[model samples]
Target: MASGLDDVIAAETTLSDVDGANGILVIRGRSLDDLARTARYEDVLALLLGNFLGKETPLIQSELGVARAAVFTHLAAVDATILALTPIEALRALMARLADGEDKAVALQLIAAPAVFTAGLLRLRQGLQPVAPDAGLGHAADMLRMLTGETPNVAQVRALDTYLVTVSDHGLNASTFAARVVASTRAGLTSAVLAALGALKGPLHGGAPGPVLDMLDAIGEGDNAEAWLGAELAGGGRLMGFGHRIYRVRDPRADALKAALAELKLAGQTPGERLALAEATEVAALKLLRLKKPDRRLETNVEFYTALLLEALGLPREAFTCVFAAGRVGGWVAHAREQIDHGRLIRPQSRYIGPAAA
Candidate 1:
């Protein structure tokens, strides 16, 4: 048996492929670059769901908008104490109130729940009333409006759409795998999504982006990056946002988000100084990592620019993982459907080394 399932292929999928050696991510036969630059979040969602749902993009968009509105009603049932939890925790609690089913409509609602809950919980925590979903707005735009109670500019919408598309799906990652495991048992989509959210809550999985910003705040200036990073490395600190488990080179998603950050900066949507500081920090960290650990090719990963992009879009650090769930829930839904259709119960055996059975 392979410990940690290394070199193990558990399931076959046509959804997305992670070419780790090449640092390539392809979703539904399109490169991440193509999708991030060109497709809207709803477009990608439709692409991911089309095979199973057989619905057109317009209908999917319409249904998803309705679903977002429908999920907003659940906020009334959420305890105020739950709203006081961190954004992700509050989102998980809110999603737990959704009914479970296997129909296409149910799948749409499950996909919409995280976005609606994330925005609602963030606003509610700020003592701001949650904005209802506008069916006329695109998914990313509506999410921003719901969070901030004001319409977002075009640049903000595009940056968020890029983020949502870039993170929409990868291979069977930890959360997606958790989602698939629950799905394999024929649990409803809501249960599978809850499993995904729980897995994403863990630090190793979805928790790095917030700390990425923390690191930047500590550095505070472009010129201070090298010394600060060197000291942190000397003190045995693991650099947040600098490496990935799957990609031996720089993560492709990192490049996609970096481009989005650049666009935001050029459009004056983000702080230019912050962008420069982050860029300098990335360069310093990469150089130091190469000098300190020549054997490991630890380079910039998605979390670095995910922090910058989301910050530029005006989301708080506490809501980073929840926002990630908003993007990744699309992948979770697609993967769950794939698993339920062609997969089996994911049971594995454990090796026993204790004394003979009593």
Candidate 2:
């Protein structure tokens, strides 16, 4: 048995190819850079859905808007129980209310759930009324509007679009694997998505990005980056955003999101010093990591820049993973469809070692 399933090939997928050694991620036939730099969130979602929905891009975009509106009705369903949870927790609670199905509408609703529920929960927690979905606006734009109750600038929309596109899919990650596993069991899209969300809630997966901001906040203003980072390393604490499981080199998504922050900064009036401090801290963390683990490649990963980029886009750190789910839902849907349509139940045999199975 391969411990932790290292180099395991459990399934074959034509969805996204992750070339870890080269640090390249290709979704379908397109490079991540091509999609992240040019495509809108709807465009990428449409692309991922592809023949699964058998709808054209414009139609897919239109249906996504309708899906957003459909899921928005559930915002009224939120009660004190939901409000008491964090944004992601509240999102999970609301999503649990959705029915499981394998239809296009079900897939699209799963895609729209995180955005509607997370934003609604955030607003409700702040004593603000939930913003209804605008079918006229794009997914990322509409999401931002719901988040801040203001019209986001072009740059802000573009950055979020880039984020959504960049993360739309990658080869079977932890959450994606969970999604595929549940889907393989014929549990339907909503259940698959819930499974994925459960996996993402773990700290080693989608939960790390929000903590990156905490690290940056504690290290404030570049000057103390070294001492702070040094103390963290000396205490044997794992740096939040420096290393990735798949990419031995720098994560490509890190570059994509870092560039997103740069583009947003160029077009918007943000506090540049915060970006500078984050940059300095990243450099310090990477340098210290190398000194500590000379035999291992501890390079910058997506979480570091994801925090900075989302902060620039006016998102609270607590809502970061939920926003990430808003993007990865497309992938989860695609993978679920693939597993249900082309694959089988995901069950692996374990060697009996404890008391020789009695």
Candidate 3:
């Protein structure tokens, strides 16, 4: 048996493909580069949902807005104690309060919950009132507004949109697989989404970006990047964002997010000094990784630039994974629907090694 199901192909999917060997990602027959550069998050959502849900972008956006508002009503009922939990925990609690259903509208609600709940939970933790969703605003824009209680600028919105689209779907990742497993039981969309969120809260799955920022902050100045990274490597500490489990080459998502960061810089929005520090740190990390592990191809992955871009967008480091969930919930919902229709219950067998089963 493959440990960690390495090289195991559990199910067939048409939603998204992660060609790790080639360092490419494709969603619904379109290359990730094309989609990230051109498509909005709603457009990608429509693509992933396909006919299971309606394909109209505007309809999805409107429905998501309504879903967000509906989810907000539950905040009043949440225990203030839960708000003191980690952001992901708070989000999971709020999501569990959403009623389950097996319908397109419910799927939309599941997709909408992460964005609303995450923003709400973060605001609540900051001792601020939760901002309601604006049905008129697009998903990315409104998420920013909800988080900060101020209107987001155009560049901020675009950066977030690109992030959401880039991470929307990525093969059968751990969280998406969790979502599919829950879906296969016919537990309903809300349950599947909650399962996905639970899985994503783990550091191995969706928790690396926050550490990436921590690494940068510790490094401090651009001139200090190489020496700081060298010391970290010498101490046998693993670099946070310079490697991936799937991609042998540089992660395609990294390239996409770095390009988004570039756009933010060009628009005069991203902090120049911070951007320079991050870019210098990335270069140093890549160089040191190459020198130290000559046998392995360790390169920058999505988490590297994800931390930078989100930092540029003014999101808190603690809220990083929540935003990741917000982007990935669409993929989770679509995969759940696909598993329900075309996949099985995902029961795997294990060898009896404990005292020969007594």
Which ten contiguous residues of candidate 1 have the minimum total lDDT? 51-60
Candidate 1 stretches greater than 4 Å from native: none
Candidate 2 local distance difference test against the native: 0.88
lDDT of 1 at 65: 89
| Better lDDT candidate (2, 3) | 3
Give Cα distance to truth, residue 23, candidate 3, Å: 1.0
Per-residue CA lDDT of candidate 3, range 217-325, in tens? 8999999999999999999999999888899999999999999999999999888899899889988988999899999989899999999999888889888999999
Cα lDDT of model 2 by residue, 188-306, tens digit: 89999999998888888999998888988888779899999999889988888998889999999999998888887788645789889988998898888888889999999999999
lDDT (Cα atoms) of all candidates against the true structure: 0.90, 0.88, 0.90
Cα error, candidate 3, residue 234 (Å): 1.3
**Model 3 CA deviation exceeding 4 Å by range:** none
lDDT, model 1, position 245: 79
Q: Model 2, residue 63: displacement in angstroms?
A: 0.7
